[model samples]
Target chain A: MLIHELLPLVGDAQSVVEVSQSGDALRELLRAPAASAYRAYVPDGEKMDAGTVVVAFLGPKPEAHIDAETVAPALRELPVGGRALLLLGWPVPELPYHRLLDELVTAGLQVLQVVPLDKVSRHGAHCAVLAARVDRLAPLRTHLSDAPLDLAGEAPDLRALLRLTGEYVFGDLLSRPLRRNLAAAGDRIKEQDERIRALEKEIAARDATIAKAESRLARARNDLADLRASTTFRIGNTVVQGARRPTRGIVSVPVGLVRIWRKRGTPGERPGPQS
Target chain B: MTLLTDAEASKYWNERHQQETDLRSGGDISFDEATNYMFYLRRLTMLMDRVGLQNNPVAPLYLLDAGCGKGYFSRELAKFGHQVDGIDGSEAAIAHCRELGGGPRYHRTTLSGWRTPWLYDVVFTVDVLFHILDDAEWERSTRNLASLVRLGGKLIVGDWGEDGDHVYGNYQVVRGRDRYLPLLDACGMRFDGWEPYRFRRSPIGLYTFTRIG
Candidate 1:
């Protein structure tokens, strides 16, 4: 499908800029949706408005030039909250999404969502609409999420340490600014660790209090049960219940007899004096 | 297009197709991304599991995606070293499938009219046969799909896995267990009970069948 046909389907965007090496797909993508300011061009480090929705239609080899070359640069320039829609056209059937996802992440973009648009787009390429928002860390850190060097344990080898330093830390780009950011990240991690410890201590204290409360509740329940079972308590409960059947009958008998005598004497007329 | 005689269904789907949104995730359905993702992932995993259980003699199983609207399942299966042929009635859907030029060969034809030179080891239809509209057409379509399955091959169908069939939105008919079990039996296929699709809000299920004859 042409870009214009596909863009509107993507929903209303403030502005859209598509970067593609190929002319035909770009032309189709640019076909008349005059409503939004949608523009298509070959990737050159042209200054795009920060929040402009940048769609990278990487035709065939998405993992190669398009991802590293085109998308990475554009993503760096994207403003915070700006979205990059990466369309990997039916390149290789076996292309795992993780690779493209990692590439997007390395460029400082956080993947918000992924939608399969293979059926809707005219090119019928295995298309994935990877919506990623530019993040704070996008400008500084420069490698994909998956690292070759294992950062788990101590790396004694000098070569391995160098590789780790190069990949993880600023080795080539060990500029003052990157170093500052790394130090800041380290400080933040330390702060988080302290906070986590405090939280754990607080949770432990809360658990102890809960346990104490539960014990008290259990004791109270047992005491109530014992009180209920006591002879005095049982007698008091019965007395509190007042008149049951037999007792009620004893009170009612005399009153019942009096009423009967009164009713028998009266009969049809009100009884005069002794009559 | 004419074979899709149910005007309401045709119109509904045609508009859906024109909407240019992902059917698996974004559509008229109120399913959020997470639910839809889980549903798709679970369905795909189940399909793979079902195929694995077969232990087919063919190294790369010859599969048919009956009523492959946008060729999602077809392409996914193709990734797993399967030769797939995707067929759909809609011209636009078929056009998109062809344009996307994955390994799966796509054809624009209804299930009833579809014919192949050779039988497939696995012929499955996902969320398609239930929308056949006419009862006779549904029967004919089932028979046609069954006819394409080789002996000892499997046919996995998607629809309502309930006891009795039900209609939804005046177009989709959830062909329950009663309707399909007998239909498969008539086609000389063994009824391998229905399995509920995981993470699906609606009772969408996978109806499994194996051609014994």
Candidate 2:
């Protein structure tokens, strides 16, 4: 059976047993250890002998059939320090599992450990499994006598364990590529920031150039105003204010003065239309 | 001449016509307004008489009031002993036509969709062609109007001649004199003549054509 091949992966077992109505799946446990035993039991009919590790493979039942009466009696029949591995395919609601665990403890059994097994298959039908051990039933009398039963453990029920495992697998499948893409996106954002800074610097340079051109234009206008104020510069008949004095040879004359001088014909002869 | 049946067209024009009337009247009903209405009716009667329509009544003259806003011209033509019909896409305009006392049977529809019940002696569309958005719709509408006119029947088109884009009330159009003549000629209608009417006051020109058979 495949279970024999798979049990080695779970580490060593001193005394393994398979208790199922049908001996097919139980036959797989024959390869666990040489001391392992297998048994088949009818519902509510058998009690385990001393020091036997009772591995019970109960088949599917209706949700209403799973009560303390149906489970506690069989679990109480186990001897002290004798381990019992019970397999079930039902989902346990909150507070109800605690009550059921309390009833099992009250029935002269000490629970050493409880393990939930996921990914269960029975001749191709998917199911969940629960495994527990019976510690010394005598020490249970003083263990949390006044307080409530402490069934808190890391392992969840079989259904929840399977769901959690599947979710882990799916989460890894979805987020691994997303994490890579996010790193690439962060790099692109940094590159864009650099480009934006470069563009800002370029804009600042262009703005400075525009300011320089404006200042130059203002200075040119001031120079033009100064040039227009000269006495040699004449607009229509008016003379400008600051210019060279009118001397004999190198005098700078206003345009109107030049025209008048030319009209007067060099201060002597008649002005013949100022040829 | 063009027959049109549009379901929503009439109701839309009717509402618009009501609103326009409300705005135009401004809640005033003076004797002067009544006199103006009567004067318009008398002028329309005289025009119809001059057209020889009053003397020899024409059954279903197949008149198309191009831009027949509220069917003002159509209603008058119908009252003057002509079996006339008008079509306009404006809901308010169509509603006004329906409200008018003893006017033509008016339809609220577009020129592109008008289908004449029979060939018409006169297919008249006034001040409507330039509202066409493009040359394609204009050509199609013009051809459709021209096709309604029987051989030797008159096709009258009134629009702005030789104008840049201009606005009148809510209407905007671009038109010129030579713009439509070639198109009309190609649609089996011969240009009879055109008369310039109200150049300064209205800037409108009325062109008359006849189906060439």
Candidate 3:
């Protein structure tokens, strides 16, 4: 058995040669005979006429390093019944390994097995391997006829079996405990909802306070404007003070009794004012 | 001091001033002094407000007055919380600007020789560049103007448009708005905006350019 590894250094060597530059390390890695078993980088998809078993060592970091654009294009070029081995450097916790295996099977690939490679030297870097044989490329071509549930023809029976099992096992042994757990979860959810409502109310109150302050500021400005208009104060230039013009003429008095007449008139005026 | 020995430029400016003085002193002007002064003051205040001078009370702004003949605009800008430096090649004009208590630092220099130790936020050259006699001087003057503006700063220019050149009183020169764009582009300057201004009943155009990388 010949084991081969296609280690790409610079350009993507899949369906199309997307990158223009080729690194020296990739050239050295491709010198071995087993490497000759795989097709080299080619730009056109139709030109990939070699390679039976295609093993794609996606990269050192599966999710972070591997280019999905390159991989998806490569997948389209694979021949039927040909094997494709995808080694992912990171394990997906959300996607169960069995479900991924089942998806590959549903996609017309017979999944031989998925293994967590612990003993392999390359496995020093965390990795998962999926070995699959392409059975039919168009498994999902006929949805009604070729669907997984339709092919099984026993999904209804399976659901009935599960219902019966739940009724017997859970009702007999663990019904009360399960109900208690569910009630506790419900109480936690209600507490969270109350906290959310309190936050909403607090935000509304803050907005109202802000609006009131803004209105008060506007009123204060209007009052200041009115005060400025009422106050008619001018600074600088002091000509408009208590300065009066002199009366035009003085009255003529008799020569002999001029002083007497002046005194008498002043005295008479004073007396008249008193009366 | 870098003075222009060009006889045409000197004669042109002298004739221009004579014409302006003649016009201003010719009529029995019935302008309300108090109202006019108040209006000018309000306009200065508004300009200061728009430029955000109030926010920066401690540090003074640096302004460049290009083609600053007698430094009227330069002095006004300095009064509004800016430290101004004005350059005009005409020696008599610079002397008159000094006598007017225009506190802005004045220099008797042509646009070609104008240099500064510091960059300015705004370079204001009003009714000046149109006096350039030829294309070479215009290009040189424009490049010098753009060089004075710091990154993200403005260059404000007011001049006679190409259409208004024939309506000259003392000095004669003409330029259009479209002519300035290519010259400014060569100097790594981009057009920001423009406004139409009429001074002493004569139509003038104002353009602004921002220095960009």
Candidate 4:
């Protein structure tokens, strides 16, 4: 479809000049249509006749993107007023490549229509920039290209003025939602950040309150322990317990009081080894 | 120091504006005058060129300097023949702006609370949103500013272009792309691009968007 779709734009070809690297699928797609097709694996400045369509597909196989070194030779071989059909394949993201376009235009090729190749094309190319060699530069409508979405393998290219659009449009329609989603996700992140900050503050306050209560509880427990270990409380408890029986109070009360009196003066906290 | 409450932050900024009379009051106070003159002002001039305002675009383009600190940008824009209005939360800042005004009308108003009848062709908030410590306030401010821009108008803000929000010191928080993009997209504003200031160690820059009908 790449050759068939562009065959009309090629016009009445006196001869077809096919230029590409050796063993590339692009060379196989180069059809002459009623003229003898000349193959140049590595073009070494072989000049051709006028009305010859220089058919070439430059893919990013051994190199990165389309470079001038590979493209210039094809232009060098192309005679004046001849047409050049180039299928450009990019390894980078989908976007308006002005640098590459400007390079082609500067090379004395008056770009006619840029046909963007689909996924199933013989060569997996970004787009086909169709142009003819002209003497003077021509006026342009728009730099951007678009066409109706075609399921069929028919070649597509050139449409719409990008800068003149009502809304500023970009290259990929698919990435639009992605960009929005990423942005919305950021909003959510900020919201979550606020929530996290609030939660952390609440947690810190709760921790302080918990610590204060624990300290007070510890102080109260210590006070109760000290009260129970007092000598007066022990003597009082003994007297009360002995008082429950008649004669027991008389002996136990005096004994408890005497023990308390001795224990009060004792230096050791608990009875020593001898005691 | 810890992050300040909204009231405390407002007080801090107002007091700051009152204390300093020069560019140091609103811009980076640490930077010397030479550095500011050579780097800071030059960077802004370049950005204005990128914004399509440097060469004097269509005359008298209505513009709003959202959160215009001390009214420098607003005054500068007004000098370009555009009707400019500046609003800031700091009372002292607005007072300073009015006293030194070349042309712009100054108003003392917070970004979130800012409400007006007029819609501007360009509403720009530079190095301001990061100062709003509260997240909800930041969102509201961004949304409100976007709302202020008429269709086919521009809304430019200064913030980090990278992903994820970053907190610096007490009052500064750099909200990333996720925080800004989705919200603005929902507002029908197509993002133009984000260009970094690229001065000193600063990662901050201008994020530009154009509202669509």
Candidate 5:
């Protein structure tokens, strides 16, 4: 997701001026360690200086054209020898990278380097980086009309073709699998994280439940033990045992009753203690 | 007269449910968005606490989520060991609820039409009745929801906790406390005090009713 291709240009820059409709590209730009002082600007009514790094993010809309009118003013502000890095959200068939380069050259910026930033940038858009040096402008008597550019063959010229090849190698071939694997791994980790959280919650709930049940069981056991040690329980036990003796069956109840009466009549006859 | 027919209501909900990817997506009210999801999460948790649904020792509380769309609350309550039945008129919504498989039985029936041999210990309808445009149908739905609750059990309704009902967006009949209390009284359900939902940005709150008979 990090456009490693733009690292070299950005690695040495101290101050970066980012122009984009959304601050997303600017935020990504500021992530580089080289960007100690980075400020973002919108294309409308914005001013910039030359000799500093400038990044412009354009497109995702093929229907919308990026003309010299939009690109020239930003470049004009850049002083001589200033670096301009143009990143397109995606390649529009109508506005090819080479045509954009031609527009920049016409606008008084010397084309230095043109390459695809990555096959797919963090925004899920194809991006190309065009690093140009601002130079003294030749006075323009006439404005160039928007016209389809021809680059010799079915493909763009060797310079553009070479950049395209680099795009395939560095952007698609190198980063695609890495991105896929990282995404899969991230998803797996996230799933496991969610599962772990759910399990922890469940375990905590079960522990509470078990503790409650254990307390309840302890209380029940204590109640049962208390019942066993009670005076009433001893009298009932004695009567039952005495009744088991067949010879004394008729007198067993009276004897047991008298014994309980004597126990109750005794001084200091506490119910549990007497039992 | 019913402004929106039963068929119209079902179609509206079914289409809306089908479009949504989750419980919080594709409605005028949504929780799928991050901010809205947070709001809904807080509101539901607070509502549960207010209704004594959180850490409830009274497990296996047979709960009826009347007009349960997509079974968010039903599934959550079922997690707390309550046997929940989620009823919705939208077939798509019921199907989606069944797919979630969180242990709540899904029934495709409107509140007025819903029938069961067993009564629920806690029957609740959250943010569902406002969509019923017909006044008579609303009364019937209220009565039917009350009927599903056992005596001394609760029937919690979610609506505006204001004095008088108002209609919003041609469908949502914001039933106020004044409108609900008499209807609940008629059905032998006692009007317990309303507990306002803590995180709701609006005046909506939990309308708790207890069946006395």
Candidate 6:
């Protein structure tokens, strides 16, 4: 399954240079078209033909550091425009592919495809990475894009490439103005929140005033209710009404006045035991 | 059918609030005070995630609390670093909001008549719109709230997501998606999604829209 993915990148290359940990599986796959020259991985400082396809099947194992350094010797043999197919063993998800991709980017390789080989993926072989060295950069598809799986390499769909490019650019364009608007909107909201806080304080002050006025009115109402319920005030008011009517004033007014004088001060205040 | 007028609806809420507890006046009647608050907070948290405010946003957002009965959502949103303006028609509700201070600004205005000089990043009404039994007033309030959303902003309304309208007692008129989608489409509001309250047997949920143009 690893060879199924690697053979397309190695299609009819002038020569094949493989630094393989997966044994002769890839060599067998390349034997069909029979590349003009085939050999083991090149030694350090040994350069290969510019168009040679380098296949590094560095399988995974516990504690193995599969990084750019692991693939640097093979990359040194690759000239500009030369492509590389790396079958990396991903031990755990903690070791993300982005870390390896970062290494490859530093090593002057552009990762064109990263395909996870579920069917024939060996114990440590997590995925297949097809990459090429380029002289200049093109508008990148997202850092992690799995949509371009057209590995046939027979007729590259220029239209689909343009469409993906357009979509990414358009989305970026939309977000630019939106981010600007959101920033401006955020400033306005901050101002408005400050205003809201100020208004809340104003409302709170007004509420305090209203509450104070309400408590005063409640106290006044209680005092009025108590006065209306008092016997002396009720009787005095009756006597006054009777005096205003006509003949009842003589006894009503004098008796009410004498009773009030005897009672003195507050009607409910009992005279201290004649002390 | 003879439904309660908007003024009568306001009066009914005022009278109800005079006797009902605060949570009962504003939230699900079936829930106790603590449950209601927790339920409301959970929903609000999820809503914050949807509107990109769960992380204490980069900038404060302008928010409108349409028909903010008792201003529960408005105050909670303010706590999330957003500026909120709460508008309601009930004299008692606005008085309560004003009494519970230090958050959103309170306005004693009907949902159909609440107009602000600037647009908002979010305009939301939670379980408050169905209480508008008058069809005309309900339409007016929906349109007015939609008009207040700026481009790329959201308008979230709490109601049903079914095809037909339903009525509950003499107070609530739950309008379905049939009545909402067309009007919002005409207003250039794109329907985002709808999710249910999912608390219990209740069918009401939130309908979200965004103004794209």
User: Individual DockQ of the candidates?
Assistant: 0.01, 0.00, 0.00, 0.01, 0.00, 0.02
**Model 4, which residues run further than 4 Å from truth?**
A1-275, B54-59
Between 2 and 4, whose lDDT is larger? 4
- Writing each residue's lDDT as its tens digit, candidate 1 over B97-154 gives 7888778999888899997656777889887877878988889999999988765578
lDDT of 6 by residue, A1-275 (tens): 33454555334466667766446666664342554466677476357765677776554453432455666767755766677777766543333576567666876776765555543433445566777666554223221233332223332235435534654576577779877998999999999999999999999999999999999987777677667647667677768777697588767777776776666656453223221
Q: Which window of 10 residues has the lowest lDDT sum in candidate 4 chain A?
A: A141-150
User: Which of the CAPRI classes, incorrect, acceptable, medium or high, describes model 2?
Assistant: incorrect
Clashing pairs in 3: B162-B175
Better of 5 and 6 by DockQ: 6
For every model in order, the fraction of real contacts preserved is 0.00, 0.00, 0.00, 0.00, 0.00, 0.00
Candidate 4 vs candidate 5: the TM-score winner is 4
lDDT tens digits, residue span A7-63, model 3: 221112333222212233222323334333334444444444223334444444544
B1-213: candidate 4 lDDT, tens digit per residue: 588899989998988888864566777767865665555575567446534532122224677888787877787677766678899989888988889879888888888777775567788888889999899989999999998876557888889999899898888889988999999998777799998888888888889987663
Report the C-alpha lDDT of model 6 over B89-182, residue by residue, as the tens digit: 8888889889998579999988889876567778898888899887887889899999887655789999999988899877888999989898
lDDT of 4 by residue, A1-275 (tens): 24445555455666666655444355455444545565553566446766676766665555523554566667755655677777766633453556556756666776765654434344566556667666643333111222221112221222212222422343245458888998999999999999999999999999999999999987777666666567766777788878797588889888888888888855324332233
Q: What fraction of the native interface does candidate 4 get right in terms of contacts?
A: 0.00
TM-score of each: 0.41, 0.35, 0.37, 0.44, 0.41, 0.45
**What lDDT does candidate 6 reach at residue B82?**
73
Estimate the lDDT of model 5.
0.65
Off by over 4 Å in 5: A1-275, B1-3, B25-32, B50-59, B198-200
TM-score of structure candidate 6: 0.45
- The segments of candidate 1 whose C-alpha lies over 4 angstroms from its true place after superposition are A1-275, B1-7, B24-28, B32-34, B53-59
- Model 3 segments beyond 4 Å from truth? A1-275, B1-5, B14-57, B160-170, B198-201
Go through the candidates in order and give the C-alpha RMSD of each one to the true structure: 27.8, 36.8, 33.3, 24.5, 28.1, 23.5
Tell me the fnat of candidate 5.
0.00
Q: How many steric overlaps are in each model, in order?
A: 12, 16, 1, 5, 3, 1
Model 1: docking quality category: incorrect
